[model samples]
Target: MQTIYIDADACPVKIEAERVATRLGVRMVLVSNGGIRPSDNPLVESVYVASGPDEADKYIAEACGPGDVVVTGDIPLAAKCVAAGAKVVKHNGEELHERNIGNVLATRDLMQDLRSADPFRQGGGRPFSKTDRSRFSEVLDRLVRQAKR
Candidate 1:
């Protein structure tokens, strides 16, 4: 059976994922580092890791394999999932595949380096919108169906 793995520490699409998973009768796991509430839904399980940077990401990556769907905004985690043959989708609906994972990781690292070089340098990111949620739902449905096959 296929499972949906969510990097839920700072993910904004947890509710969206749950709605889609419930509708599709799919199992979902939310991996966190001790901040979110545990889900009461029988189909949804929460796995809390030790409170440390990247602990949740490590757990999520280690737990996922082929035929799994991982939702994460972290570029490195997304790359890892893609390399593991697991389908990866960002909360904003972008699909991460082998073709683009390297570029994504490089861009993320470049931005981090730029920010670290200058304390006052501010990195800009767009806020999640309803349209993003809709796109994610649609893409997730498609990915889930593909995973099932």
Candidate 2:
């Protein structure tokens, strides 16, 4: 059976992911420490892991497999899921695949190093917009349909 595993911490599209999962009849598990509210949807399950730094990440990675769809922005977790044969997608609708996971992981490491080296570097991404939400819905719809096959 296929499932959708969501790294719910700081994820902007949890509701959207639930909608797609519910519509597709796929089981969706939301893994987090304790911040996420439980979902009322039958197809959705909210999993609260221990309050360790990567407990949720470890749980999601261990549960995800060949027929799973993982939603997360954590590049390392995405890389691990991709290695485990699951299809991974970012909240902004970017699909992380085998073809590009390596480069993405490397760049993530590089960026982390740069950030740690510079104490004055303090910036974040643009606000998540309505257009991004729409795009994520479209990509998730397509991915769920493909996973169902």
Candidate 3:
């Protein structure tokens, strides 16, 4: 069975992902440390892992496999899920797979190194916008439909 695994910590599109999963009749697992309200929908499952960095990521990477769709912004976690044959998508609608995971990881590492090299460098991405939300919904819907096949 195809499932949607969401790395829910700091995720901006939880409700959108849930809507897509529910509409597609796919099981959606929200992994986090805490602070997430449990969903009443049977198709949605809220999984709270131990408190720590990457605990939720670890769970998501280990649990997701082929035929699963993983939603995460952590590049390393996305790489792992892609390696495990799961389709990975970022909150902004970027799809990570075999074709580009290497470059994505390398870019992420380079950015981290550059940030570490400069103490004054600001660390943050652009704010989430309405366009991003729309793109995420469309991409998620498409991925779920593809996974169902």
lDDT of 2 by residue, 26-111 (tens): 99999999989898888888899999899999999999988899999999999999999999999999899999999999998988
Misplaced by over 4 Å in model 3 are none
Error of 2 at 70 (Å): 0.3
Compared with the true structure, the alpha-carbon lDDT of candidate 1 equals 0.90
lDDT (C-alpha) at residue 134 in model 1: 93
Per-residue lDDT over 1-149 for candidate 1, one digit per residue giving the tens place of the 0 to 100 score: 78999999888989989988998899999998877898888999999889888998898888888889999999988988898889999999998989989988999999999999999989588778999999998998889888888
Q: Go through the candidates in order and give each one's C-alpha lDDT.
A: 0.90, 0.90, 0.93
Please give, for residues 28-141, the per-residue lDDT of candidate 3 as tens digits: 999999999999999999999999989999999999999899999999999999999999999999989999999999999999999999988866889889999999999999
Q: Worst ten-residue run, lDDT, model 1?
A: 120-129
| Top TM-score prediction, candidate number | 3
How much does each candidate deviate from the true structure in C-alpha RMSD? Answer: 1.2, 1.1, 0.8
